[model samples]
Target: MADTPNSPVVDAQLRRASVQERLGALEVEQARLRQELVSLSGELRLPGLYLTLDAAGTSALLVADAVQEVVRLVELEPLPGAPPHVAGTFIYRGSPAVAVDLAVLLGVTREPALDAHLVICKGARPVAVLVDRVRDLVEAPVLVEGTPDGDVALPWDGTGLMAGLCRTPEGIRPLLRISAVLVGSEET
Candidate 1:
């Protein structure tokens, strides 16, 4: 190959590959840091929000990272022909989102109170989980040996939807499976 002003000298493909390798390394480092942060929270025994969805004591919650926010319940537009569990649609941050009564979806009989609030879930697609009320976060240390009383049966089992009960000072609280709640097992 003869050198000429118009001829490029460097191997562009090799340079691009080098940058990609660096990016991959950075992503792995980011994941590790995230794990460390979660571990630190566990060590501190930090409190987390747990909800009482029904009078039967069927409670639920998402991982702190999976929760976006808890907002006041407002009028929701009914989704015609939709399942009873569907509370209709609400505008979330200017985007249309379906409001779901977790109790209804779970086949719980109790009705939500007038002051019930909506839980904004975070994931591939955000969805609203309507609960009776939002309780302040509680420190959730894993229980070694205690009978959890409020475990709600899902429509189906064997799918990682149930996270078991975490014994809190108040009582046993059911952990919500973010994937199952956000995207139902049928959808999955």
Candidate 2:
């Protein structure tokens, strides 16, 4: 009603701005929903030893006094007829070991260039999970449900990587899924 000539242009601009605002609102709503879902499902924190290493040796997380110790040496073997993510197989404590590239397989930037450690998970299939550094292992909460950021957070049907986050002195630690790492892409 204000003006006849400028109304069309003004209307078009207003419509465009409204669309953009709606899109932004949708994105924010989606993020909030994801966070809520994750909170609802829940995650469990298990008590175990965290190991970190580098050119030097392995170190404990919880106990600061524990001196640096060398990771147990093992022989790596090729997982013949396996997937790409599968680094190889190794023998640890006189048992078959399935080695995987922690960074590449898990979608990390790269192989932990610095410190590396093996997380020994004892379960149906005892396996050692390779990690850049074993940041302290505090009680980590579980992610009940949420839209993960990307494949890195939920790789291979939510199988490749671990779930939940652990806050440590070093930084936020991603709870590595021993099962996912053990299975590799082949299973996915």
User: Candidate 1 — number of clashing residue pairs?
Assistant: 5
Output the lDDT of residue 120, model 1: 87
Candidate 1 lDDT by residue in tens digits, 26-101 = 5446435544654566432325555434322455545565678888888888777777767778899988887777
**Top-lDDT candidate index:** 1
Candidate 2 lDDT, tens digit per residue, 1-188?
56565698788757755664564455446435545665665543334454332211222122212222334434446677876555566666666656555555644445344445555555333455554565443432332333334334333234324434444455434444333454452231
Task: Flag clash pairs in model 1.
Answer: 47-138, 47-139, 48-137, 48-138, 49-137
Model 1: lDDT equals: 0.58
What TM-score does each of the candidates earn? 0.60, 0.46
C-alpha root-mean-square deviation, candidate 2 = 19.0
Q: Which stretches of candidate 1 lie over 4 Å from their true place?
A: 1-57, 109-111, 143-161, 185-188
